[model samples]
Target chain A: EPEVTQTPSHQVTQMGQEVILRCVPISNHLYFYWYRQILGQKVEFLVSFYNNEISEKSEIFDDQFSVERPDGSNFTLKIRSTKLEDSAMYFCASKFNTNTGELFFGEGSRLTVL
Target chain B: AQRVTQPEKLLSVFKGAPVELKCNYSYSGSPELFWYVQYSRQRLQLLLRHISRESIKGFTADLNKGETSFHLKKPFAQEEDSAMYYCALSGQGLTGGGNKLTFGTGTQLKVEL
Candidate 1:
C-alpha cells in the first residue's frame, strides 16, 4: 500500500539556524498538512496545504514558518530560525478527500534544537 | 477554536476485559471525529472514523452530538490492543475552514495478562 514518507527521521540543529523537513505524500492525495508534537504533549496542527498553497494556519505557524510544495511530489516545511522550544516531532499527513476525514501520517521527523 | 480532550492519560485492563477510551470535543458546528492508534514501533494510523460507522478490529466509536463526545469502545480486548490512542476532530462544515484536525493528548492503553 502507498504511504506518506518523510526524510531526515531525526535532525539536530542549533538555535538561530534554518532547518527543512521534507515529506512526499501519497501520489493521489490532494490535501496535505503539517503537525507538531512536543515531547509528551498532544499533537498540534500547524498548517494545511491544498492546490500548492496554504489554506489555513495556526498561531504556532507564525512568520518563522513556511511550507512549500516545491514539486508535484515533495512538500516541505522550513523554519527560518530555530529556537529551543522548536524541539519536537514533526508529522506530515495527507488525505484524498475531506469527506473521509481520514489522514495518513508519515513516520515523523524528530527535530532537536539546541 | 476546536479542542479535543482525553481525560485519561493511561488505562490498564486485563486481557478479555472490555475497554473504553473516553474522548470529548469542544466545537460549535458539526464535527467530524476520528480515532487514531499508534502501536509500538509503528506510525500513527486511522483506527476508525465516526462517519463510516464501521467497526475495525472490534472497536467502535459513537458520535454523541448532545455531549460532544466520540468515545471508542471495544469488548473483549486482546493483548494486542496495547497502544496509544488519540482522538481527533476536524472542522469541515459551514463556517469552518480547512481539513486541519485538533487532536487530544492521547491515552495509553495497556492490556495486561
Candidate 2:
C-alpha cells in the first residue's frame, strides 16, 4: 500500500533551537495534517494544510509552528523554538478525500529536545 | 468538542477466546467513528470505519448511534490481535481547519496461550 513517508526517524535538539520535520504524503492526497503524541498522552492535532494554506490549528500550534507543502510531494513542519516540553512523536498524515475520512499516517518522527 | 472514550486501558484474553474493545463518544452533531491499531514496532493504521460496515481480519465494529458507541469485537482471539487499539471521533467541521481527530487514550490488548 502507498504510505506517507517521513524522514529523520529520530531527532535530538537543544531547547531554543529550530527543527524541521519532513514528510512526503501519498501522491494523490489532497488533505495533509500534523499531529503529535507526548509520551503516554493522546495524539493531538497540530495543524491541517490544503491548497497551500493552513485550514486550522490548535492552541499548542502557536506562533512557534508552521507547515508548508513547498512542492507537489513534500510537506514539512517547522518548529521555530523548541522547548523541553516539545519532546514527542510527531506524525504526518494525508487523505485522498473526505469521503473515506481515513488518514494514512507515517511511521512518525520522534523529536527530543534537551 | 468531540471526544472518544475507551474505558479499558488493558485487556487480556486466552487464545481462541472472544474479545471486545469498548468505545464511546460524545458529540452533538453527526459523528464519524474509527478504530485504529498499532502493533509493536509498526506504524498506526486504520482497522475499520463505521461507515464502511466491512469486516477486516475477523474484526468488526458496529456503530450504535443511539448508544453513541462503536465497539470492536472478534469472535476468536489470536496472538496477532495483541496490539494497541484506539477509538477516534470526528464531527461536522472535518473538511478543513485542523480536522482534528479526538482519540481515546487507547486500550492495550494481550492475547495469551
On DockQ, the candidate that comes out on top is 2
Task: State, as a TM-score between 0 and 1, how close model 1 is to the true structure.
Answer: 0.97
What is the per-residue lDDT of model 2 for residues A73-94, given as tens digits with 9 covering 90 to 100? 9999999999999999999999
Q: What is the DockQ of each candidate?
A: 0.60, 0.61
lDDT scores in order: 0.93, 0.90
State in Å the error of residue A7, model 1.
0.7
Q: Per-residue lDDT for B45 in model 2?
A: 96
TM-score of each: 0.97, 0.96
Indicate which candidate wins on TM-score: 1
What class would a CAPRI assessor give candidate 1's docking?
medium
